[model samples]
Target: MAVTDPVDIRLLAALADLGKTAVHELAAKVGMDPREVAYRLVALSGSGLPLLVGVESDPQGLRAAIAGAPPSWANRPPQQQFPAPQQFAPPSHPVPQQPAPPMPPGPGPQGVPSGPYNVQGAPSGPYTVQGAPSGPYTVQGTPSGRYPGPPPRPQFAPPPVPIDPAVSTWGLPQTASWARGDEPARPAATGKRGKLGEVMETQGLEGEQLSVQLLEVQDPADYLFGAAGYRLEAGERAVVVHTEITNRGSIPFASLPDNYLELLAADGTAIGKAPVSLTSRPPHKIGVKPGETLGGHTVYVLPDATRVVSVRWSPRPEPDERTLTWSIED
Candidate 1:
């Protein structure tokens, strides 16, 4: 198909996946002009398809236009139902779309960072989180006895820039109740703490807590990292993992797992069992209650300081796990 086809598909997919989206992000993700995304969004919205497009700013003042919620396009054109592509039409009248239930101000389940929720927008202090990053990066194929069709993969699924929810300050969850304090917690490892999954058909629990920190959209490159190292000697050469965990959520979150560190190759390949790196801390489970945080670190000892590649914190429960990643040159 032509390039335009993908844009149409993405517009439909965005609604299907995110529930709602803005025109700029829709355009950016689908490689289309903002006007086009807006145009399609208007059409879809009028046809009873839900979508939201708006402007938001980060802590540093960078602005971003966002959109979410895609409409399904199962039917072909001509015979398919099409709505006017101008104004945003709330789902056809009469059928009456139900209003969202009001959320209470209390400690809720942990989830992810997604919303336009806001508070005073003023930051209180340096907000800290609880655990390490989610599912650590897996090294691409290491040649076994025989090789497969392709090469080893070092895919990078970088987490979204951590966004601190502002709701907590006002005693409400505007963006999410994610245990990670900032990022939404994935159930895969959180072990049933705070999560945001579709429980019911039309209604359920969601991580709708938005902290003022969400206003701070960090530059991916400017992000400071935290790493945990193991089995070290004296001054071999790994950046010390001095970490601090603070609870910025509305509810209490679990602690960093005992096995929260690993020695991976430049491509995130694991070297061995990530030894327990709870240096100078209790040997028990580590945790942070709402409005609290914890900190820990490890001294990295390089076998050959010259052969040193890099280091990082492994995956743990807390959703927005901050980590340290770096490389040493010969």
Candidate 2:
């Protein structure tokens, strides 16, 4: 209870819930540096607050503790335990302890220190030739090493794929396909095509193969927009176009015809879809499954006197010359 640090209290709570955790694991949970957490744990244990019952020395025991295995020293201290780190020395004076034995220059047993493994090396000791094995290594079974490599990287989950509201379609499984070194090159498209309104299939930029057909056109004086529950104005006439689209290839088609529907006037003017409509399927947001065909209607309202010479059917607005145009005029 004497510990006033909110961070220390949070760390203690984490230790309680987790039983015995490594310094790195505790640091990750509490968002603190491993060194800082280790120092604090040492201080807390030395404070006689019963936060840590005793220091673990056995390699297998420490490993079991880190692995969330039942703690060996839970309610009682170890019968024979190593000493805790010394408390902070006064600013003006230094604290002295027993000096560590000198390590011989030649290689020793298993390339370890001459004496028993000292948790902390001498305050002033020369470097010893202790080569380590390759790959990850753990110290005191605590998962630390002399030349500690980079910290473990975080694993991130992939972003969710957007769903289309038009229809229930199964998305193709994600695949990474690469051409082999000896694979032959695909021949270029000769750009062979037919006039607008003719039933023809083409591949989209995203590799979606689709077959599109502009079936019929009608200009009506009275128009009923069922969705909005409204009718067209007296002077305005509605131009409705019936169309059919099919997903011709293995890839799924997710384009809505409403976005690319355009009405071009005789004098080089463009008109968008009218606010009034009577059709149930507006082709505004629809997806078609492979080998499936869907029919829809798009309506445009224009002045009765305006001469609509053609209906341009492009995959998108601002399309290139390859886009199709149908003669809608009677």
Candidate 3:
């Protein structure tokens, strides 16, 4: 966030005054090497300074910054170069003193007098001493202090009042304009959607980037079926459902390791089924290759009844009953 220094400041000012100037010419005016000028320009460009546009200035638009311009600051006859030092002269006159009585409005010498004192101790202009404006005017005085009014006003129509578009973050054109049109649209978000269901029915639930995907059924029926060859009465699956998986995920465990698929029932069917440490299915390596699909399933029984029946299948990973009931809007 280094800021532009005095050199940059002068460069910018000169550029404004010169409009579109060549780098070499800019170097000359601002007193820097052409290379340095280019470097500074680049630095300024990077710093989000005023935008530089490379277009020919409209001749009519530039009239105000040129000779015989509308503004007094820019108005000058041709054949004259910049910094016209001798162009204006302050006519000599003495600093007018306090009025005789200094009675304002009642005025001896009307309004405050202006300068241009002569060697003879006389005001070069008939600048009034202290009082109100006699008639908004400047009076030039002779060496002897004889005052004379200004010459007649020039006969020229006033300059047109141009619109000022000076958006003021930078002192860029107060009259710049833009054309209108639509811009290009942005990209849409993207990702894949997979079917979530019973292990046998579910699609891939693989972990993202680098890990094994998991699908578990903690619903009581799963526990009952895993523990007991028979799903117990009033028992439901503790393992709600299982996810179809592909084990490509990185793990601290070895590629080939013991794993089990189990169903637990709320009604103690698991202990009855077999009380082995890892019961239900025999252990297998889970050493699945990428994209490999494996199936597993769970079942549940009705609660508070000796009756045992396989529960109807439902959508896997549905957020809630409401989600299942929601209708697709047209």
Candidate 4:
């Protein structure tokens, strides 16, 4: 019951990072099978981990599963467990017989037709039957005495069941560990604000320490944007923020370092980062190794009238105390 398995620990750590993801997606994150993920979650929940394991089923699929019937999506005929009963019928007409040929004058063998005799209306010979069908005689239906071989065995192929776009194959958990009060409260954000070119250390999702610094801020970067073969809408201007991230802990920082970097507007609205990248200004790569440093450029397009206040960075989707902000000077 105690969570001591290394695999279970890894699964829990991934679940903590992912929050509420599908079982298969969580499995992909941990390099395990979806069924295994589901089983482990169930076991962990049973062990008082406060984990929630839930399933979603198609209405028709539930009925089929309960009734022991093939799902409608399969589009197959009902299986015939045994071959159809064989039917038999007597021949429609009797086969005609011919009279024996006349024998020689000498006394013939007693009770035997001594001379050549036509058998079954054919020229006389030993063990010959005239007009007999080549194979077993037809037993039923048609008057013709020909046997049709057993009905061709029904051809069956695995059914192509349609997957529901809304549901994952391994189903989804209704609630995550955090929602079930299993995870500790998120760390409070430090009240400190750094100016541009100042470094601030923060903890990553996996407890890895990282040093983040806002290196440069470019306002009205339209010329650079245009040079990148991109066009902006009228009244829109681009801003590019360059930052450096260094992993200071032994653990590697595996996520995009600037994923949640954004600009705070003068009116307190948060402007999100754009996906556009500049070729000359290389964008942030995926990860930073331990003791390694990486620089990244984040681009944002906003209305020219909007006054940018500060640059904010957070490791999570939502800004928290761990988030760092750098005031922008006009």
Residue by residue across 1-330, what tens digits does model 2's lDDT show? 487999899888767645565565556545577778888998998988776643323333233334442445332232223343334633443335655456444233345432333424343332232454332333444323243233443322223334324323323211112112244434432232344467766665456787777776776634344344656666777777778878889877654544466777899788877544464545444567789888888878788888887676555434443355666655
Which is the leading candidate under TM-score?
A: 4
Q: If both were scored by TM-score, which would come out higher, candidate 1 or candidate 3?
A: 1
Off by over 4 Å in 3: 1-228, 235-242, 248-291, 298-330
Clashing pairs in 2: none
Q: Residue 280 of candidate 3: its Cα lDDT?
A: 55
Residue 234 CA displacement from its true place in model 1, Å = 11
| TM per candidate | 0.23, 0.38, 0.17, 0.47
Error of 1 at 71 (Å): 49
For model 4, the local distance difference test gives: 0.71
TM-score of 1: 0.23
Q: What are the lDDT figures for the candidates, one per model? A: 0.34, 0.57, 0.38, 0.71
Clash totals in order:
57, 0, 37, 2
Candidates by TM-score, descending order: 4, 2, 1, 3
Give the TM-score comparing model 2 with the true structure, all chains together: 0.38
- Between prediction 1 and prediction 3, which has the larger lDDT? 3
Rank ordering of all candidates by lDDT, starting from the highest: 4, 2, 3, 1
Off by over 4 Å in 4: 1-191
Candidate 4 RMSD to the correct structure:
18.4
